[model samples]
Target: MKLHFLGTCAGTEPMLDRKHASVAVECDKKLYWFDAGEGCSYTGHNMGLDLLDVKNIIISHTHMDHIGGLGNLLWNIRKLTQMRSELPHFDGVDVFIPNEDSKDGLLKLLSHTEENFCCDYENRFYGVQDGVLLDDGKVKVTAYHNTHLVRWETDKPLSYSYRIEAEGKSVVYSGDVGLYTDLDPVIGDGCDALLIETGHFGIDIAYDYIKDKNVKRVFFTHNGREIINDREGSLAKVARLFEGRGTICEDTLTVEL
Candidate 1:
């Protein structure tokens, strides 16, 4: 399996070498996108990734920084299919979103685009709820609601974190949380890798949270001013604190696991 980092910056003013938060996990030649941050599709395509192979797109929340490129992503997929004269690997694509209003708004916007944004392939949207979101025999994904966003209603959750298990390896994605404890449900006993966000928290806080959690590796994304302003210093701190188990991810970085 391969992990591709398309965007790593937090929801802040534009940065030099980063966008928002986005990543893709490729297993068995199929792509599963984690977030559709700005320029994610463009970055992935330029990095030689096959966008047509994307079978599922899972959004952590409806925040603009997280779903900014969603419409453009779908548009690019259709454009590429027409340009290549080839059908997508899958007959349809599945989009898991936490908010129905965001999905409806995006679809409404696409309705006025070129060709009415119509295509031969189907693009279906599903509301993300806690529990197992996907299980294809090869990869299993479980969603856990987080406190990043508040929901007055008890039934619907507004944000989530994910646990991905595949090929005997477990990976956890901490999609923006109000507190580190918000991921206890998904982290369970432990995981091989944890893709954590440092936008609302500090690196030390994250390190302390998972110090004895049995995590093998930690990849930091959705960075904030602390890391962005002093990258070298932050990296040095991570090296000393994590002892080679943590990394500050950059755009277009691909890791084989």
Candidate 2:
């Protein structure tokens, strides 16, 4: 499988080469989108990715930085199908959002657009929960609530971090956690790759949090003050700390896992 970083910026003003937060896992020619940050689909599609190939869109929270491009993503997919003579190869597109309101709000907004947002493909939405959310033939996605959202209820977890398992390999995505320890359950024993966020925590904090864990590779995304303020300095500091275990992710960067 391959992981594509569409946007790596956080909820800050525009940067040079970063957007917001989004990633896509490619398995069996199907794309599983995680977080639809601003211009995510645009960046991915322009990079030669087929928007129609997207099977699932997962959201960690309802923040604009995370879902800024969601409506555009759906619009672009429908536009692609209309432009082409053929329908989408996949049956439908499924979106998993942290709350029902997020999906409903997006649908309402889209419905107000052209042609009442009519489309040629079936797009389904699901509310995210803490459990196995998707079991595609090639990969299984498990969601565990994190402390990213302030409106989370103790009885019902709406925010999440994801553990993606495919081809005997696993990767954990920390979707803007409130704290690194919030990923303990999702992290579990270990993972081949950990797509962690550095928006809220520093390099040293991240190192300390995962020091005793069994993470093979760490790719930092959803960048924050440290990286945005001083890219070279942050990279150098992270390199000195994790040596070969860490990588500062960039927008539109693709990695094979």
Candidate 3:
């Protein structure tokens, strides 16, 4: 399986090297997008990724930084399909979003476009709840709720972390978690990779929290002060704590496991 990092910056003002928080997992010629941060699709496609092969889009939450480019992504998909004069090879796209309001907003935003704005291809949207999202033949996706927001306590507990198991390896994506322990259920005993978000927390804090955990590789995303302001120090801290087990991700970086 291949993991592609499209954007690695947090929701800060524009940075030179990074965009936002987006990643893709490619397996068996299919692309599964995780988080649609600003300019994600553009970066992904320009990096030689076949965006037309996208089958599933898994969103962690509705934060602007996370879904800022969602509408543009859908528009691009449709634009490419029209350009080719063929329906999407998959014929359908399944997107799992945590908030229905955000999804509805995206739908409305797309509806106002040109050409009567009807998508020739099929796009199915699913409101994600806390549980197993999918177990495709090649990959397994499970969602665990966290405490990022407190708007609607009655409906959803709020944010989420994800555990993706594929090709004999497992990866945990910390999607703007409220706390590190919020992933206890999903992280469980161990994972091969941990695509953690450093937006709300520091590198040392994250390293200390997962030091003894069973993760083999730690890739930092959605960066914050530690990474942007004092990168050398953060890299030193990770090197000392993880001893090469940790990696600071950048836009367009790809890794295979």
Candidate 4:
């Protein structure tokens, strides 16, 4: 499986050479999108990725940085299908979002675009809840609620972290968390790779939290001020702390596992 980093910046003021948070896991020629941050689709396409191959899009939360590019991503897919005169890889795409209201709002806004935002393929939306979100034989994805956002309603969780298991490897995507411990439930035994966010915490905090865990690799995304201001210094520090097991991810970086 290949992990693609589309956007790696945090939800802070805009920065050069980065957007927000977005990643794609490619397995068996199919793409599983984690978050649709700004310029996600554009970056993926420009990186030579096939947007039509995206079968599922899972959002950890409805934060602007996480879902900023959602509408544009969908539009780009539809535009590609039209231009190529070919159907999408799947009959429909499954979009798992924690907030249905946000999804509705995005769809409503898209309805005003060209062709009424209509396409040949269906873009099905699903409300994300705890437990297994997808099991497509090739990959299994499970969701665990996090406290990044408070839940005013009792029906479902408002924020989440994901555990993706594919080809005997388990990976965790910590969207944004109120605390590092918020991921204990999903971390479970351990994960092969942890794609964590550093937007809310510092690198020292992250390292201290996962040092005892069984995670094999750590890729830091959603960078905060510390890493943004002094990337080289932060990377040097991470290299010393993690002994090469950690990475300060940048946009368009692809890693195979």
- Clash number for candidate 2: 0
lDDT winner between 2 and 3, please give it.
Answer: 2
lDDT for 219 (candidate 3):
97
lDDT of each residue in 120-165, candidate 3, tens digit only: 6788999877778998889889988888864665855657789998
Q: Provide TM-scores for the models.
A: 0.97, 0.96, 0.96, 0.97
Q: Which ten residues in a row have the lowest lDDT in candidate 2?
A: 150-159
Clashing pairs for predicted structure model 3, backbone only: none
TM-score of model number 1: 0.97
In model 3, the runs with Cα more than 4 Å from the true position are: 86-88, 153-155
| Model 4 quality (TM-score) | 0.97
* Ranking 1 against 2 by TM-score, winner: 1
lDDT of each: 0.91, 0.90, 0.87, 0.93
Give candidate 4 misplaced runs (Cα > 4 Å). Answer: 86-90, 153-156
* Per-residue accuracy of model 2 over 125-209 as CA lDDT, tens digit each: 8888889999966889999988777563555665789999998999999998978999999989999999999999988899999
lDDT for model 1 = 0.91
